[model samples]
Target: MPLILFNKPFQVMCQFSPHPSRPTLADHIDVPGVYPAGRLDADSEGLVLLTDDGRLQHDISHPLKKLAKTYLAQVEGTVTESALARLRAPLDLGDFTTLPCQAVRIEAPAWLWPRTPPIRQRADIPAGWLALTLTEGKNRQVRRMTAAVGLPTLRLVRIAIGPYALASHPLLPGEWQEVSPLEMR
Candidate 1:
């Protein structure tokens, strides 16, 4: 079984199928027969895992497995301790409640590459960075969570999934590399 780690770019759709306007994973990865183990939203960027093995995909994505996914979110306005506290607690997001996970204010990572077209900037409102780790994923969960606490996300990036991390294996946007599945264990 082949597992691939791809550095997905912002605004790139997470599917292999063609889109009417935006680029898809097919536009970046040419390796056939492989599908994303989990998904990253088109507006979001960074580490996405793809694999050809069904069982491996299931193991990586299944919520029951509790594989930690870490994201770097640049949100509008300064992050307060109150907001961080709310994020650290189990958050009620209407449809489902998010499990309590690690949420912390962090300095902007030095290794982060600038997003193309860049995130919108305002002269008055300052932006803050957060490192959030979640065991479960929901559609637009991070964005919604931040909004619930009065901070809207400007840029979102998934830097790690389970044992694999972009910090250890850095790849520029639209880049990818094949890796052994055993490393995931």
Candidate 2:
């Protein structure tokens, strides 16, 4: 069983399961035997894991494994240092408090691909970066967390899964590649 790293693009579903009305992981990934290790919402993008080994999938996606996932979120609003600090501190998500994590602002780069249906452009509104890390992958957690902090996420990209980064692997949108065994740890 080999591991695979994919740079999932926006509007792509994360599973091989078919959706008659929506595009799924199947539409992009043709590799047989490998299944997604974890899921990214169809609206979100980047750094998805696929593997043939069921155990490996469990290790990567299981909550017990606590594999830290890192995301570079482009959020709407003028971000302040206070907002960054708030993200690092514990967040009460109604059901439970999120674990303490890391977050900060970053410069926007031109390398990002233009979304097919671009986020509504508001000339008066601004956008900023937030590097968020979490051990738990809740349903739309990152987007929800940003919204809770008054910064709605316009674009989300999973920069890394454990030690592998989408940048290093570099899969453009629908592309995917099998990771060498040495890199799967």
**TM-scores for all candidates?**
0.98, 0.94
Please state the error at residue 111 of candidate 1 in Å: 1.0
- lDDT measured at residue 107 in model 2 versus the true structure, 0 to 100: 88
Model 2, position 137, has a per-residue lDDT of 88
lDDT of 1 by residue, 1-185 (tens): 78999999999999999999999999999998999999999899999999999999999999999999999999999999999999989999999999998999999988899999888999999999999999999899999999999999999999999999999888999999999999776
Please give, for residues 1-185, the per-residue lDDT of candidate 2 as tens digits: 77888888888878888887778888887888998888999889888989888878888999888889999898999889888887888888788777788887888856777777887778999988888889888888888888889999998988888878876887788888887655556
The pairs that clash in candidate 1 are none
Taking all chains together, the TM-score of candidate 2 against the true structure is 0.94
Off by over 4 Å in 2: none
- Model 2 sits at a Cα RMSD from the real structure of 1.3
RMSD of each: 0.7, 1.3
In model 1, state the lDDT of residue 127.
96
